[model samples]
Target: MSERGRGDRRGGMSRGGRGGAVRGNRGGMGGRGGRGGGGDRRKGREGNNNRQAKKKGGSKVIIEAHRHRGVFIARGKEDMLVTLNMVVGNTVYGEKKVVVEGSSPEEKKEYRQWNPFRSKLAACILRGIRDIYMGPGSKVLYLGAASGTTVSHVSDIVGPTGAVYAVEMAHRPGRELIEVAKIRTNIVPIIEDARYPAKYRMIVPMVDVLFADVAQRAQAQIFSINASNFLKNDGHFVISIKASCIDSTVAPSTVFSKVRDELIENQFKPIEQISLEPYERDHAVVTGVYRPSKKEKAPE
Candidate 1:
């Protein structure tokens, strides 16, 4: 009777163990299926996000050449200057940046950032000065080239055929100008005082334009002297006059009038005078012809 009882107990334990194994298998399969579905859903969301980004802005960059010659407009969800990089992958003074979209071994194209805030010339350009006179292949005699920041942009505009004679008096800034000139072959950096144009007489030839940004009491005199030496007959002159530099106590209008009169007296015919009020207060850019020959002079 004891043996029969023990055999019956063993058979019952075997059946219970088989039932648990079948239930465990079903639970395991359901958990795996749920996990797989969750993973697929996450992947679908990631793909949707990528598609949306592409629709918002098709590409990373889009550059269009500007209407103005030697200028370009860059659009990367924003608008900015399409400038040529003087030093590849390097900035002179924390200016904007634009990458060259298409380039090749035979011909390399590069673009750098032109910031209006940093460069007065750039501001003037944006202000719509009809003829800057410093275009491609133009010979420019630039006075007061501070650190060559503007000079470098001018170099890019003028291209290899053109030349820029940058003159800065101070030693420290002159050193920086030299570095910029080294990179851009067309620039001729002259570390000499602009007040005395005769000092560097041998280096500068008759230029198409004479640009002066000196902040001296006699700003007109400095420009007159330089134009007389280097500007060709009927050549243009763009002078940036700062009223405070001339006389802080005097009214800004008074200062501008005085400068304009002085320029006419020196034989520079004033064509148009524009005030850089919003960009720069108490500052004006005077554009005119330097000593036009009697034949070339227009009728009043």
Candidate 2:
């Protein structure tokens, strides 16, 4: 049996819809996780009221930041909108210092940002994923961390106390991710294909969340293999599926169904699935819980 519900499609709002519309005070994030800063303060429209922080040195560059709801607006050279609950500043090794302090992150709560592009996480937010649980101290397995755009946000979310094992198959991007991780203590970038978690088993700890953005032909299998070894029993697997990546011949729905079946066989219970349109074409971010059988459950 299978259950279906709404999925996270945050940054997707910028798609199909006119990108220019975001240029207004609202500032549409056309899928790039629009990082805005500076200029006159706007009205009391609450941003993301979650925790916020920063990394700096002897007032080298004081990034003026404001909190609104779950949004963090940094007034530096440019106006940047990051989630207060996620991470504080860019993970730049030599200069990565918490300029401002923030509340500790939650271990098992889903958090989103107001990014309109560059990451499926942003799309998932715009789509309204009420079940997302990316918070502090969370051990996340990021499948596709390209150039560390969304990885930075995730690093902020997990905070210094938490850990994020970013897995990227591409060497170039993985190198950049490693560099980024150098600044942030929590993010540990691993240069390996997410398909083979066993090879990197020594590095990846049991994770609270398995976030996969790798759009591949055998993505479901990829998620299954990785989840089997690393996903915690109560953990959640957040996967972004691209229809084209699965099969161009059959319908997108078929691809999703097959993927779900594969995950179910792997002991992952389906939670939610929603199409990531506008932001990402023919794509979806699916959430599932990994609950072992009574026999598989370890002694408490």
Candidate 3:
């Protein structure tokens, strides 16, 4: 992959210089001021609707760049992770989010808040993952991209230069993934089981990173298979493992240890690991490299 397709410098996507800083409406007109003087119920209702539309659905909302590249925290009344909406005014699922257009047609830009509870990758970001190795122009292979909720965010992160090969086993979510891919040219929706990487080898390419959030018991094995096939040598990987999926009877700590060992045995050199606690129960995110050359030792 080209260098531009693999590296997106952190803090590179901030819009502050471009006058896209996070905007807030703390001085919004009070509801009491919304009281219509006539006291007519019909007028009152209309006034209320007009005021509500201005407050919630207004075009004054601000979309600011977050600390992480390609990620945004929006401000109006509450804070939310916003993306440049891939599909204008359309939501893939019933996710809690809003889309706002700029003041003029020349400055039209949309943003969507990312939810941590519904997505493991979002949880990882909220949990303070240093580097997911994803950025503008970085190609990614996403396993278990169900319904394209998180994949949408990944698509935003990669921007238009890169691509995401999203693999889903079920036909139901695959349809939605296709719809998301339709809007975002960077996404390549693959309707196939991730367990067998060879099945979709023709469609996938050597990616900068491989991310897997599968719930299968043999998730580590699945990650290894995909890494060997599409992941570039020494490429990074992030996998979300659900303890209950592997063994409900075992403790989460034990489950994580076993999974880590399995990854090591498969030639993966783990770099960082974090628990997706509070946001997710009995879950963890592991970041690592697929393979590495042996380090040389100095002569004694």
**Which candidate ranks first by TM-score, i.e. highest?**
3
* Candidate 2 wrong stretches, greater than 4 Å: 1-81, 85-114, 292-300
Q: Considering summed lDDT, which 10 consecutive residues are worst modelled in model 3?
A: 1-10
Write down the TM-score of every candidate: 0.76, 0.65, 0.78
Candidate 1 residue pairs in backbone clash: 83-111, 83-112, 84-112
What does candidate 2's lDDT look like per residue over 1-300, in tens digits? 111111121111112132421211334223323343332233111221110111111111223322212233333322333443343333322111213332544332222233545668767766776565677677888888876767777777667777888888999887888777777677888888877788899998788999888878888888888888888887888889888888999998988888888888888888899877777888888887888546667788
Tens digits of lDDT, candidate 1, 110-201: 55657665567766666777767776788999999989988888888778888999999999999999998888899999999998989999
Tens-digit per-residue lDDT, 237-281, candidate 3: 999999999999989999999999999999998888899978798
Error of 1 at 28 (Å): 35
lDDT of each: 0.71, 0.62, 0.75
For each candidate in turn, give its C-alpha RMSD to the true structure in angstroms: 22.6, 12.3, 8.6
Candidate closer to the true structure by lDDT (higher is better), 1 or 3:
3
